[model samples]
Target: MQPRKDNAGFSIIELMISLAVLVIIAGMATANWQGTIERHQARQTKQELRTLFQVARHTAINRRQMTTFCPLDAANACTNDWDQPISVFIDPGSLKVLAQPDYLIRTFKAMPNGTLIASHSGPQERRYFQFNPDGTVHGTIGNLTWCPDSLMAERGVHVIVNFGGRIRWGKDRSGDGVVEKASGQPISCA
Candidate 1:
């Protein structure tokens, strides 16, 4: 009798188990990918804010012009999503409204994943934080808080651009000014 050959491959049951394992792996991979994207989006928002802050400060100092940073709304409020739009402009020499984009330095739209909201320490109507040619900002301690919609998050980000236009980011303890602290991030003018 000829030696019987055992044609063996993955049995149906073994194939099913392998498929299940693969599905689980794929699911986990997808979740991880989504998380990475979300975190990236958040970081991108903060980086953008930092960039704008530095650019505005430098432009004011270099151009010897008053650069203004403000929320898009005239009310100076960011009630929409976490990603809010903002405007930056240089004041016309005449001190009138920015001459229809002539003085517009940069216009930024918030990312969908993150919102940029503003809350002033003083008056509500005033939005613009004008920085003089000397890099001195003209505002009190105004606070802008950025956080995810979920409260379960342990840490949130805050941008405190003192009236002097000195920008720093840190944690927002109470989401208010009662007790805010910095996260030790390097925020330098140079």
Candidate 2:
């Protein structure tokens, strides 16, 4: 009888090549996953802000009292730093300060990783949104822009609050990957 040769296992070179390909694929997948996570964080931040605005407006109208949505400082006074923990509270006095803990309707935690900028129609920085009992904004219209730490500023989303207290989201309308404001100008984070 003729002797038979065994070829039951892969060569060392073949195994090494397969491992290299797997490593490359894993690297690509990791990059894609990171991008997806960043997008999700941005989207979540936008939605949370929108919900807070709506809640503040509705609360003001229903309770027949002024409602303020803002980030509070150590003194419980409103601050322009939107990255701080935000609160929706009944401000019957329009003092922009949280007097009693019972007056707080909701408190939103700060963003995990990002920069939040709130600006009025002009060059003024928006410190807070005060909704009148009639559900209209008390001051100038403004927008809240959230920029992810990993992405460009223009890639972030915008939550605009009109004078009527209506909330809307602004996105890239020109397909240029940059969000625009009401004037069709690209949003500048700097």
Candidate 3:
């Protein structure tokens, strides 16, 4: 009888090629997953900031007092560093200082390490902003930009507050991946 051919298994080269394709697919999936995570984090940060501002404004109007929203240092004093944990408090004196813990209405934990929060309030850095008793911003309007320290800078978002204490989101009207400010300027991350 003639020798039978063994065609029951794949060749070594074929197995290797299959594995290579699987590796490539896995790499692509991992990259896409990371980008999705970064985008979600950025959006969550933006929402948190918007909620904080809204709470501050409503609190001021409901209590008929000024409500301040700002990041506090170890000394419980307002600081320009937006990365620190933020607090919303009733500041009758408008001193921008966390006088008593009881006055604090809410506190948001600091953002993730690779995340950044920058406030742009004209030339001078505004450590904090307060809502008047009438639910209007106490001073000049500004915006807070949230960015992730990754190659996907386009996933960043912005929370803008107008003079009337109305909070709105920055958009990418030009279909660009990066968000734009009120003036249609693209947001840049350092």
Full-model lDDT for every candidate: 0.61, 0.86, 0.84
Best by TM-score: 3
Residues 92-160 of candidate 1: C-alpha lDDT, one tens digit per residue: 452424545577788777645544455544555345556788888754555555544431132235577
Worst 10 residues of 2 by lDDT: 150-159
User: Which residue pairs collide, candidate 3?
Assistant: none
2 against 3, candidate with superior TM-score: 3
Model 1 superposed RMSD (Cα): 7.0
Which lDDT value does model 3 have at 63?
93
**lDDT (10s digit) by residue, model 2, range 1-190:** 9999999998999999999999999999998887787788887887788788889999999999999989999999998888899999999889999999999999999976788888763666788889999999997788888888865765588878788999888878888878887777777766
Residue 183 accuracy (lDDT) in model 2: 72
What's the TM-score of every candidate structure?
0.62, 0.82, 0.89
For residue 39, model 1's alpha carbon misses the true position, in angstroms, by 3.5
Indicate the TM-score of model 3.
Answer: 0.89
Error of 1 at 96 (Å): 10
Name the 10 consecutive residues with the lowest summed lDDT in model 1: 181-190
Off-target runs (Cα >4 Å) in candidate 3 are 7-10, 112-114, 122-124
Candidate 3 lDDT tens digits, 112-166? 6355455656775678989999999997788888778783558887878888999
